[model samples]
Target: MSDVPPPWLPEDIDETFDPLEHADIEPSPETPLIVTPRGGDREVGRSCYQVDTQHGRYLVDCGLSQGTSDKFPDLRGLQPQSIDAVFLTHAHVDHCGGLPVLENRNLLADNAPVVTTPPTASIASLMLEDSLKIHRRETDGSSAVQQFTSRDVAEVCDRFHTVGYGGGRIEGVAPVSDVEPAIFQLGNTAHLLGSAWVVIQTSGYRVCFSGDLGGRATHLPDMSPPPESGLLMLESTYGDTHSHPSLSGARTGLWEDIERAIQTREPVLIPTFAIGRAQTILLIIAERLHTLSADLRDRVEIVLDGMAVEGTDIYHEYVEDTNYFAESLVNRVVESGETEPFFAESFTIPETDQDRQKILTRAARDGTVPVIISPSGMLTGGNSPRYLAEFTARFGNASVFLTGYQAANTTGRTLQSQYQADQETVSATIDATPFSTDWPESSDVQWVHAENTGDSELKTRISFSADWISLVEGLSGHAAQSGLLSFARTVAPDTIGLIHGPDYAQERLGPHLAENVAGVDQVTRSRRMTPIAVGSETDVDTAVISPEEIDSTGYTELEDQIDHLYELLSKLNEEVASARNEPGLSEAEIREVIQDEMEIKE
Candidate 1:
């Protein structure tokens, strides 16, 4: 939230917020208080939150993740017309990328005055258009699912309205218009160029939503959580202390690993987010190779897959609120390019088919002394997979390096599967909640190694799931988590609902006032389907919240649905067992595992 008032805000501060402020907003304990996390829970990124009161409704960040394609918030599901307004926190694809897709959707009403600060609005437009372009390129001319194209994104600009760090306005409409009702205050979270931590104020309640807490005082500004809040929806990206590694430590470790891989004369593969991490990794690599140690220099061959060079520009434009590392990273890529003709003036960008082929050919060679960098940070869907298929064939002494938070069910997560070579074939359904237990064993992962084609040694790479990277970055950008907690504690809400991060992160986040987040009380959450929890007893449709009670109102029904599958599979397994040596593993044995997992579900 900046000092300037958005066109949507009312001129009268104490007078009252717009009624449209709470469109489609759910009910909350604070006369008008309502908090609903649309995405980023029990998973990572694509975060959206709704704050509503009987008076009005307003949304804080409306982005998407893999799950966004699911029924509710996708272009098809959301009634954009009903949304009163939208507040953007930052420009990260996960946090702000989904807005444009809203245009493609059919809406109940059709106007949410997509409100955001100037910087965030400008940058998100550009980043989202780029994302749409890439998505279309990959989708074979079909309607790219869950992606917004440049034209669609351009349409979004018309909806673009401005807000400052303090408070902006979107005037017109009654305090209790047809739109849901609520009041929201947003301030810079400093997580990125224009990130913001949201504050929801209702007639009788107050809640502070910690969008995505940034890290400690890194190169960027440190954010502190508000001192008190009736309800605190904080992101525990770094909830566990284990995630507390200094950036310097990560930098040092990354260098050691890269140097070792290069020594064997193999390419070092790093799959990173085009938004931020990709450049950060390169700068660190350059610093380690050039300025830090001379031995680290020559062996390092840097190669890029796509428009990562352009992404550096996006980060550069927002340098004021961004960290020194990100700002300097743009400059670093330029200097590194100037180091030699291949990268410097003669930059061999992969625009045409032939260019892409060359980039791949060079990076795939055994003696090809280069560090190949690509976008699709989590390796979910990008050129990274193509390289893996090509280079790993020969067992080159190479490795794949991952440096972003991988969303569930994505190709990024699939890479961790143990059995692989030219192709991957394994799928085990996972329980999304209760974090620690869900992390598949390290053995299940296929380690990166060099494929040797006679004398040529092509190296695959290692992976890094920077789980705490968000938490740490969020802390520094928002007020420190401590400051935010103060605001939550003060609000003293009767019911607190948590959303917008992996379940592990929320599970790890203790209540700002020492209570457990999922430990009963009035709250609602979902992994795949819907689970609604209510505090007050008056509502007929809502379930009552009891202390120490873990709400699972629909758990039984969902379990039954899952059970049905297990039962069929079990029967199939028995029949398949009749065939002693069958292709694709005994159907019966596969059934057994499903049956066993089903039992565990109960």
Candidate 2:
């Protein structure tokens, strides 16, 4: 195994080939895109977003949710049988977790288009198989059932259309939901390697849905915004104030922290986000360890805890597939000693539980020393939590190093808590915030938007041969602030819908958008499972009027209505408190109810 390279990257390389054009599905304008509930709703946790259009409605993400089925309804009451496709954004569970569920149910059987980046298709299947093992263990053979099986995942993969950054067009499927489809493209959003901003020109609306956008860009690839846009569905993750600060001080700070943690001889646990962030840290670890002596390097063992290692394998496999993903820096981990930034040994596990338990037992030993890198970055759920439980109290010298952004309500956020896990309870400080709820809130949920670069071409590639300098000091992803302004100015849509983030950031950004910023229109965000009237210029006098039924407060949850066993919109908005006042419906019913509720929102 050590002598051979990953089969995906054999010597017969095809660097000039583009994997995205594998299939060129075209579309027509008559299709109307419909949004469905895949996950990510008002309740928090889990990320599922679906888009349905005439070209044949499909999904964007199918994240596993934390809240009750009553709370996170399927959103689209569409009969599971009717749904046509599922587009995976990245391998993260929040984005791809729900996919297995769709497969197990055999929803859309053979018909649903499983669209994704080549890398995403491979990595997601690997991650899901791992997740199934965890679920099986946690649920302990409960007959309740699981979301997906490896075979089902394979089935979906068989149907996948590999679309690379701006490769253009969904294979066989049209861009419009209900209508004939035409060419469309994917832009690199850079949140994760395969994360994208899907661009489609349907009817008259040229929309670009921002997948998670990373803060800055260097080795990572990102989606370039369309040349012109009628509607820009931008992400607001960083819609608030600036998300990541200047890279200027980030690296220096990271080194100082790492040095401090290592000096104690305690194992420093770096909880890494599985996707791009994990790879970034790996290279950073490789480069920084170069300055340390052999003595120090031997003591600093690096463990791959989260899905990142597996993800890295996928990224490395696809390295030849994309110009943007590079792994030479990380390949040096084993030889790192004497060379300065040497890590004792970096491990990519056997993808088995006994192996995991072995790693944990070793981490808890008396003389074992090192740094472990694991995924499930948010800590909502992942191998990192188990590691945290074993090593948190063992050594005062030991520090849990958070290497990625901590999302809200996740375990990663708990790191910031003054509390340590005490027995079954967390020992929060006297001044600490008390959460009587079953789980703690996520602390690392910070934000950063990659600035738009206004760069695009069918066959364009950038040359980057920079050394792996300090990582904390690096920030690049979203269009630069200037890029955003320029994109806004050029499109100058009569009105642009600035959605995806906190309300105020959108408000502030809206005003800051220069007047010349092309047809910039009204800025709106769908913070809740609710809707606001969408008005058109010609109909300005009447326009699309908001439903008089809106509660204004916006926390409305419509009671489930069954129309011939199909869920449909209802007039009465039930208080969430009454979410399950009625019996929790079966998965089939929830799927329908979710669809019904969203229709009313539109």
Candidate 3:
């Protein structure tokens, strides 16, 4: 091979040219808006994006990753003191969990405010406090260092600048001299109690961020249409899925599962996300409680536990706020004269260990069919695992329903996989409290409390039959592929960057948008640590600096063809494996079958 520089490189560039040496250059008013994906580029958790405009630097969301070692956003190259503001979209831990870490690491400026909606601020207070407790507990006897303290969480909350939906000029952000100030607006996304999509205008450019879009929830108002923008950064969490089962159908399915469990006199345990899913499930059951026979309704017990109790309280506090809720909910609250919209007639809150124990004992001995709702939906933390251990070890016919997305490596995902594979039993190692007293000798459960340590590390192993496991679908808070395409068309931006999804999903959605959505000149799947620059008149420029990172947008036409070949080969391999089980199937037959499948997928 001839020793020559690639034609794409600048003619003056040589080995002596260093990119890092010029990294300290300050951005000027003429510089294009630069967006760096610190996290949530090709993954679903820790959704943090760093945007640099001529006016200032800002973050869309700083969150923690669930069920992974890389928990916090990659903030290595960022200058903490230079951040002008942080815009939070909602109160989900994956979206807002890392705020305290910014405070702890001094990554945020002293005067920079965290701007969000009022309901988000209220719900985040409870979410952050509960998150701190989990953080302390998880790091107690490990080499992993604690990220933040309760004091740091309090400091982050103190900096919250509450803004309502619609347009407003952001104050307190550092501005460059002789430049226009940044303006912002929040649009209701109906993903959660106060989730929103944010549009920020600065330096003669408007950028829109779809911070976890969803519009199917009936309790929240319909999603507001986002204004047109020069560039749109959209979330692709469910981009591979064409559509979701209707909400009403999913609710009916869940109710049928619960109804079957009740008739069998079995205790039902539902592990749900504390903020949104928990409240939704509670309301679903409450609305149907009166339909059951009077005796059955009187005998059933609905127990709410963990952080969900506090989250539901915050929901009630905002019941009258039109910006946070839909008209149907407010009217129901007013017409029924009920202070708590989520509470059922048999609602019970377990305040202490004894209270929880009594509920468990009654279900075990008296055959009381208590329906339990708890937090930490992934079964990674909170009282859900503890309750799971107790129910698995004590009751033979108990039902455990997983509600919402179960991230990789979580106990919920493990159980789900085992059940899908038709396994006889599911086993998981969980953290729980040791029993206060010994159970009957016939039980398989065992526990020994350490003499000197607190109750944090006392309890241990649990095993359950797969027959008790059920996964309730169609409860996600993210939009599917069709919704994402619609949102993109509404904005009708020149460029679209897909973030907060897996590589496979982004791969499928990118081409769909390029082919279906008009006026979109470029569709790029965000890669972490890469900078994508957007300018007014110039084509979108993606700077590929790291050798290990894959350029999602093929740099040349030949590269695009090679990437497509690899994708087809991967699909063929999967088809071969699946066909191996078919008896007497010829290789040619298998190839024909695979070709048909590929045609349908395309």
Candidate 4:
């Protein structure tokens, strides 16, 4: 991504590290390519795709859609039992959250080999375990039978077949049952630590799946050079438009906000995703702190909250093995075995209420300012809500910096919209627990009033006299419109299928791909269940690609398993009702028996 290594990078590593050039990749060409997008078409989540050939059936990235009702991929017409393998791109929940559920429910082949980079395997373990814990707490047993348990996630991790990027090493070519042998290789996409663009050779053709390609380098890895493919399935998360602040501009904007907060002795609050975004923020602050004045540095403190602490630890864990991190920083942490080497310079990770109160009290003192980084980047949940309630409403002593995208329906988006409203007219539910719990108005505290200047949309910064809020860009993991187009042109696939983006993104990227890639037979934007047959000259739009025509033994098996589970549960419920109605058993006796049974099960 850069010809010259930044000053922060170690001198030992090569500036031009192209992982693709030396890859010993070999592609086999077959015919009758069939692709059915199970999810992540015309939307940004639940990104699963089914690719079928005479050789095998493959499921790519079984993710969950984050929404009012979270959705898993539509495996309606395919049998999970027939799936030869599961290939994961990265560990982002939206891209890989459904794996444990699928495998646990027998929707996937029994202990099917899951292939991904090593770092991704670790990250996915953390995310999956965290998700199940959080889900159980949130639902409080109100939901139906669990799809997967923590034990199931542990099993999934044990079954992961790890692979490394570059050097053309094809992993998992062994045939699963009668399925034809297939080979897959991973290349760094630079989207996240272990993120990669997969190239699978099967069915006599090479298929490339761009699993969230990153357009530019941040503190993480750089995008690998494009690999040749007969059929290309690309992500269009940022394909609709290319206009956004440059990484440098974003950094400058954040720095200005921090400087202002420092001068005013006000605290700064940054809401970010714990995984990628928070790590980037920490790297930025750690690198820049050396340039600050001694007095300012002593007076300022940086705090991490939520999953960011664990995510940052994982970042350091991979420092020695991955090129994405600076070697100097990695060596320091590695040598000292410090969970957070950056914390040596006034950084805090509050564990209890007392710790938080102490930090808040210290920040309230004159000449001392604290910068807080919290999670659930969208502000829909996590510690960010608490921080936002405390900081954003204040005038003259604080600022909020949104460092990434704010998807619709999220609190982050609501805050952004309110910031753009003409007056303090846009009301929102902050849902923060006030510092003084005994306050009489605490129960009624949901609405927050902030004077909006209504100019946030015109630019990144919104000023309201002494207080402000800014939207900083260049933190997005997806490639820009031109970047996606250029990547497609470089790959120059015979057929292209777009997914993992909104309708607007797909609509814009499809034409751009068709125009840019010469001799392209078709560039189709896929919706759920839409099949784009590879090596077929027929126009995809007019083609009748029915679900029945596709060999979906995998989805069929999944359906049967689900039906069986439901039948079993229904029978148990009926039995329980019959027992309750039995003449010999009193109501009290029945209740006691059911409670005893539940305890026994537990």
The local distance difference test score of model 1 is 0.48
In terms of lDDT, the poorest run of 10 residues in model 1 is 467-476
Best by TM-score: 3
lDDT by residue for model 3 over 45-101, one digit each (tens)? 888888776667788889887564438776655655767789998888778989999
Better of 3 and 4 by TM-score: 3
- Which parts of model 4 have CA positions greater than 4 angstroms off? 1-32, 141-146, 167-179, 322-344, 392-396, 431-466, 536-602
Q: In model 1, which regions exceed 4 Å deviation? A: 1-30, 37-46, 53-55, 67-80, 106-112, 130-151, 169-184, 202-204, 236-243, 292-296, 320-350, 356-368, 393-395, 419-495, 502-513, 516-602
Off by over 4 Å in 3: 1-32, 68-70, 172-179, 439-443, 446-459, 537-602
- List all candidate RMSDs to the true structure: 17.6, 20.6, 10.7, 22.6
Regions of candidate 2 where Cα sits further than 4 Å from its true position: 1-55, 66-73, 104-109, 133-152, 167-179, 215-217, 326-368, 378-380, 407-409, 419-517, 527-602
Tens digits of per-residue lDDT for model 2, 1-602: 01122132234423232111111111223324333233353223355554544545456666664421211224333444554656665666656666666666655635667677877778777766776665665455454445556686667657666766654444455233433453466666556667766665545555555555552433453335555655554554444343244332344466566766666655666666666667766655654565677766655666765466667777666554343442332323223323222222344453665665455446556445656677655444566655544443333335655555554545445444323322232321111111121112232111123225343312111111111111232333343333344445544544444444444555445544423243454544333222222223211211111223222322111321122122111111111111223322333444456666556443
Global lDDT scores for all candidate models: 0.48, 0.47, 0.75, 0.65
Give the local distance difference test score of model 3. Answer: 0.75
Strongest candidate by lDDT: 3
Cα shift from native, residue 154, model 2 (Å) = 3.9
Q: Ranking by lDDT, best first?
A: 3, 4, 1, 2
How well is each residue in 217-301 modelled by candidate 1, as lDDT tens digits?
A: 2233334344345555655554433223334445546766677676766566677766546655655554345442445454455
lDDT at residue 116 of model 1 (Cα atoms) = 68
How far residue 457's Cα lies from its native spot in candidate 1, in Å, is: 30
